[model samples]
Target chain A: MITLAVDCMGGDHGPDVTLAACRQFLNHHPEARLLLVGRPERLQGFAHERAEVVPASEVVGMDEPVEAALRRKKDSSMRVAILQVKEGRAQAAVSAGNTGALMAIARYLLKTLDGIDRPAIATQIPNMRGGATTVLDLGANVDCTAEHLLQFAIMGSALVSVLNDDPQPRVGLLNVGEEAIKGSEEIKRAGELLRAAAARGDICFHGNVEGNDIFKGAADIVVCDGFVGNVALKTIEGLASMIGGFLKEEFSRNLLTRAAAVVSYPVLAALKRRMDHRRYNGAALLGLRGLVFKSHGSADALAFEQALNRAYDAARNNLLERVRTRVAHAAVLPAAPDMASVPGATPPSPH
Target chain B: MITLAVDCMGGDHGPDVTLAACRQFLNHHPEARLLLVGRPERLQGFAHERAEVVPASEVVGMDEPVEAALRRKKDSSMRVAILQVKEGRAQAAVSAGNTGALMAIARYLLKTLDGIDRPAIATQIPNMRGGATTVLDLGANVDCTAEHLLQFAIMGSALVSVLNDDPQPRVGLLNVGEEAIKGSEEIKRAGELLRAAAARGDICFHGNVEGNDIFKGAADIVVCDGFVGNVALKTIEGLASMIGGFLKEEFSRNLLTRAAAVVSYPVLAALKRRMDHRRYNGAALLGLRGLVFKSHGSADALAFEQALNRAYDAARNNLLERVRTRVAHAAVLPAAPDMASVPGATPPSPH
Candidate 1:
């Protein structure tokens, strides 16, 4: 049976959402067991045949500084859940806590895989093709070198391969323009690195793609630094929500339009289901030594369940082994000199 | 009466769209005159009392490099249109040609205003509040320093003030996060410069805003580096189109949905009208000594006419004079140390 560690005292709703999600998740996956990490009193009376509470005294507030959470809260639920992954007590860990604190503790406790400079957050976004496009470095490392991007591409490719069952998933480097000469120097250098890696049969690089290409499903996987990815992701969310609001207002404009809304209810409902971001929750923190998935901090019970199911699937599919093997193969290739000389070139120390 | 220079042989449809737009634009504004610049052979037989064909020998291809179009094609229609603005033959110049080529020529000929290091591209985007937000540095100056962003904020605020009739428009610096400690070193430093400018009463700074805030109408003016701004703008365009395609597919699904589509046609049309990007055409190239506006390369006759109307309005309202006055006032503030040391800190060499 695959086991998953849950940060029960995390996210906006905390135990209210996480615990309810756990109940639903358990009903769906009979073979999966949960190691619920949180304060004993908060998680009390959670009686499931496959579930056990791992009590922790502290909880990391969503707005707390990463340093304070990391240094001061040693026994915090978020950290303890991640520790379960480090100790092999669980195959994967899931959290909807403070992203900064979660990433810091995961990096410090689980550490990064060999040949990976920094772990990147990868999440799925809805695309025009009806399927989803996986985008990486959501908000983990802000200032990334070309080498870090290359690593993200490799890791992202591996994740997509396992999830989509595509042997050679297409990888596109996100830039301002599709042309090679369009973006900043770092992006140009990363393009060269990605091309070289593609030559080694590491990935199928689909050249450069613009921001819109992400939603157009131009490539199976889109790679970018955290800053750009974060901004792009949030922009998509905002635009989608705004469009939704406009649609509602338009439908309710008058009696005729309101009646029209009723006649077209199924079409609108289907559209809503297709565009619902909650279905695509759970961003994987790839390149880590252990498996970790982060759900949105404000995720509802249904969304939290999706995150839990994603973690269970990753653990069952041996995603950690797959990432390790691909990264090992990629590391054997000759490193580009320009990528090696980037200022923050220190290798990540493995825990 | 205001005379506007038009690049007739620009954009994908060339004279087909521009000439038709000119005919319609002239009908709407009786006091306005157009100096249509293009090859004589292509401009033949188009006669209007308010429109005069100014012969040009060459045309810049949509995909031509900036250097080739600037130096090699000196007599290009795009160049001749801007030449009219520089020579005081027209109050403003409008082009639907190659953006890179147009910006390079405009900068080379008209140059920048006093104390402005780089000219930025500013365009209006529909917001949730039924109004539009002005975003600057759409794709002109990619690698921007803190000082360049400060100039963009001042210029964007000035544009919004004239266009939206808000004397003190709120300006927001776009970043990955709203927190002061978030984003790259350059963005953090830019925040300081923006805050200092706000203190000096140069602008009504709204502090840092995320990408979603652009659509949420959090501020009247959003300032960002060209790279990020371009990416965000294109991403929004791509998403809007994708959403459009999705809605069409949903409404046309089978016979029942198709029947419902007919009933809901009015609501859909209203939504489409509100979300129509064509209504928001014409990106102003700000900080130039002479006024210049860019139409999308693929704009149709109606869209191109909207750009012409925008140019006419700017000229009629004396946007250039307003921008000049605001920038001059901002230059008197004590410049931040970090902004002062940015590379390429030389004062603009005005025409």
Candidate 2:
């Protein structure tokens, strides 16, 4: 049976939403087993044939500092869950707790894979082709170098290849414009490295793509520094929310519009279903030795279940092994020429 | 009567769309006159009492390098149009041409205003509150320092104060997170500068805002480096387009859905009208000695006319003088203590 570790006390709703989601997730995946990590008092009575409770003494607050959480909360649910992966008790770990603490603990415990400098958060976003595009570095490693971007591209391409079942996924470098000369020096240098990597047949680099290309299905996998990717992702969420508000306001404008809304209920419902972000929950923290998935902090039962399913799929597909092999191959490629010596090349620093 | 210079040979559609827009614009604004600058052969037979054709020998190709367009194409229509503004023959200049060429020429001719180090491209975006937020540095200067962001805030606030008629427009510095410690060092330093500027009554600083805040109506003016701003703006455009394509596909799914679409036509029409980007076509290039507005390259006649209307409004409202006054006032604020000595400060380089 495939086992997964759950941070039962994480997220805004805590054990209530998580426990309910675990129940639903267990029902759907007959071969799946779960280790629920949280305070014993808070997780009382959660008994099941396929599930076991791992006792923990503390919970990571959503707004807690990474240092405090890492140093003070030794027995926190988030760290305990990640320990399951480290100890081989579970194939993967999932959390919706404080992102900073989660990354810190994951990096400290599981450690990064050989040849990988840092891990990236990869998630799926809906695209125009009725399929989803996998984007990486969602919010980890805010400032990244060309080398980091090259690593992200290799990792993202591997993820998409397995998830989408495409052997040679198209990898796109996100920039201000499609032209090679359009973005900052870091992006331009990253583009050069990606091009070289493409030459070695590591990935099918589709050249530079603008932000809009993420949703336009211009490429199967889009790679960017965490800052740009995070901003782009949140901007999409905000715009979608604003559009939803606009639709509601217009549909209730008058009696005639109200009747039209009734007639269009089915169509609108389908659109909402297609655009629902819950279906795409769970961002994989790739480049680490073990698999870890992060769900949105505000995720409800249904959304949490989706994240569980995503983790299960990654484990079953041998995603970690795929990343390991791809990264190993990437290490063999000749290092890209030093960009620092190139005029105007601004080497990125960590945030 | 207010006079506007028109780069009649700019953009993808060229003089055909621009001249037609001028005809319609003149009909709406009886007090407005147009000076059409382009090749005289291409401008033959245009005989409107309020419109006059200024002969020009060359046109800047959309793909031409900015250097070539600036130095080689000295007598180009785009340059001639800006010359009208510089020579005091026109109150404003409008172009639908290449953005890079236009900005380079405008900056070269008009120069930046006193106390302003760089000009910013500011445009309006629809928000959930049924109003628009002004976002600046769309694609002008990619890498921006804290000082540059502070300047953008002051200039954006001044523009909004005049256009929105609000004495104190909330100015937000766009970042990855709302927390003070969330983004890169440059963003944090920029936040400090913004707070100090706010203390001096230079702007109504709303503190750090995330990408979603741009559409959440969280602030009246959103200030960001051009790289982030451009990416965010284009991402919005792309998502909107993808959603539009999705609606069309769903509404035409089958016979039943098609019939429902007809019944819901009015509601959909209202939604489309509210979301139409054409209504917000013009982007003001602020901080220049003379006023200049840029329309989208693919703008149709109606959209071009909207840009013309925007230019007229800015000229009437004295946007240039307002920016000048605010910038001058900003010059006296004690220069933010040099942050270079601060640990973890990444000094931003001009891109």
Candidate 3:
């Protein structure tokens, strides 16, 4: 059975969405089993023979402090859920609760990968391209150096390889330009280190990609500091919402436009499904010793189901081991300066 | 006549798109005067009398170092065009040249405002609301502190008021959450400072906004550091391209889908126009002592025309003066802090 731990009391929608999602996951994957950790009352209604309820009366609210909240609420559903992963009681953990809380408990419980100083929250973002781009450290580490960014690249590369099933994932350093000297002193230095590593022919290094490349999948793995990653993630979110708003305005502009949407409904529906956050809900807290997925707080059942799929894939792939091995190997290896000549480095380093 | 300087020797597309854009601008706005700056030999044939030729024998290529190119090539179109802005020969300068060169010149000539450490490239990004959202620091300072972010918030708000004609345009700190405490320590510090500023009514503050807010037009102005801003900008570019790819793939799915696109062309056209970067080509170097505009390096003639309009607006509105006046006023005569809550604790503290 693909066992998963569910943070039943996490998220804005809380138990309602979590319960529905668990049921949905079970329905879709008969092999999937859940250890629902939350207030028994919340996880009680939909008691499945295959799903067991772990009593946890507390939760860290969306607004609570990360450190204090985690410490104060030892029995909080989010923490209890993480503990399941810590104890190896479940292969993966999923939470839609406070992200800070999730990250903290996951770190405190599961511990960081052997050499990782920090564990980054790895999430799939809708890129300017057709596929979702994986950007890490979206929140986990606020202040990061070049060495940390290098580790993120290694872990991210491994995650992308497993998730996308790409034998050699192309990794790009997220920056303002493709030029080596572009950005801050740190980013410039990071670029050099990344190039040095890429030269060894260990991982695919696609050089520098800008914000536009995030969505374009210019590289399977885009690494940056948390601040930039957070901004990029939000920017993509802002753009998606902006486009959604425009479509709504356009379709509502006139009866003709609305009629046009009906005729184009199939294509539009397909497009929406292709871009839907629900279909791409789970974000991996990469570099962790175990798998922990942070779902959007407002995620509905469909999104939760998607999270389950991601968790399952993650568990089956032994993602943690892959990341751990790659990171360990990358840490000791010499720099690969030769990857600068990656076939696609010219006018369009758009990422 | 509205005289606008065009850097014919700039951008990947160079004079081909640059000349076409200039001629088109002149054709559309007969009263508008065009000063094409480039190699006299290359520009003389295409520009004729409608657009006067400004002899610039050298050009800045995409591959060359921005500073090196600017320093070595005294007669380069990029330098000459910016020089025109400095000399007051042109009300505004337009360049598809090196962004680094334009920013350097603009900063060196225009100088930053008294309280402004760095000027930012502010652009109106297309949102889902069918209207545009103004995001700043598209490419300006690569590294910024919390204090710098505060300045961006202030400047971004003023730009929105002038550009969108909104009364006290709501300003949001681009972050991963709507909560005041949802980002890096820097962002949190910035958020606290923003909250404090908002309490004092410095500018309309709307707490934190996520990436989706960019498209949703959640706020009139979204403020961030240059590093984050660059990532966000490129990410949006990536998303736009990705959507284009998705549409292309979806429409090519089958013969029936192709036929449907024919019927759906009008709606698609309207949506595409709303999202087009050409309409928002002009990027004002905000916080500068004087007004400066940066066009897309690959900008065609249509894009150049839009840039001209942005420049004219900045010039006519005395945008630089307005920003200066507002900052001077806000910084001066410190308004009473939010003393309504506490009578004992003084607000005067150290940064």
Best by DockQ: 1
Look at candidate 1 and tell me the lDDT of residue A53: 97
What is candidate 2's lDDT per residue for B86-168, written digit by digit as tens? Answer: 99999999999888888888988999887777788999999878789899888787767888889899999888998899988
* Candidate 3 per-residue lDDT over residues A48-150, each given as its tens digit: 8789998888888887766677678888888888888888889999988777677777877887777676777778876555577788767665567777788
TM-scores of the candidates are 0.94, 0.94, 0.86
lDDT of 2 by residue, A12-47 (tens): 999999999999999999999999999988777887
Residue A78 in model 3: shift from native, Å?
1.9
Chain A TM per prediction? 0.94, 0.93, 0.91
What C-alpha lDDT values do all the predictions have?
A: 0.87, 0.86, 0.74
Candidate 3, residue B233: how far the Cα is off, in Å: 1.0
Steric clashes per prediction: 0, 0, 41
lDDT of 1 by residue, B1-351 (tens): 999999999999999999999999999999999999999898887889988999899999988877788889989999999999999999999999988888889989998888787888999999999999999888776667788899899889878888888899999988777777777777888899888888989899998888899999999999987777877887898888888988999989899999999999999999999998899989899999999999998899999999999999999999999999999988663343333223222111000
Highest lDDT scorer = 1
Query: Would you list the clashing residue pairs of candidate 1?
Result: none
| Interface residue Cα RMSD of candidate 3 after superposition | 10.6
lDDT of 3 by residue, B1-351 (tens): 557777888777887887877776667766667678888888878835657888888887756665566468778887787777677777677887777767766666666688776677788877655578888766566665677777787788777777877758888887766765455566777887777778777788888877677777788788876677767776677777787788878877888778778877777788888788999888887877666788887676788778877876766666767788767755742222222122211111000
What value does the lDDT take at residue B40 in candidate 1?
88
| Candidate 3 or 1, higher DockQ | 1
Candidate of highest TM-score: 1
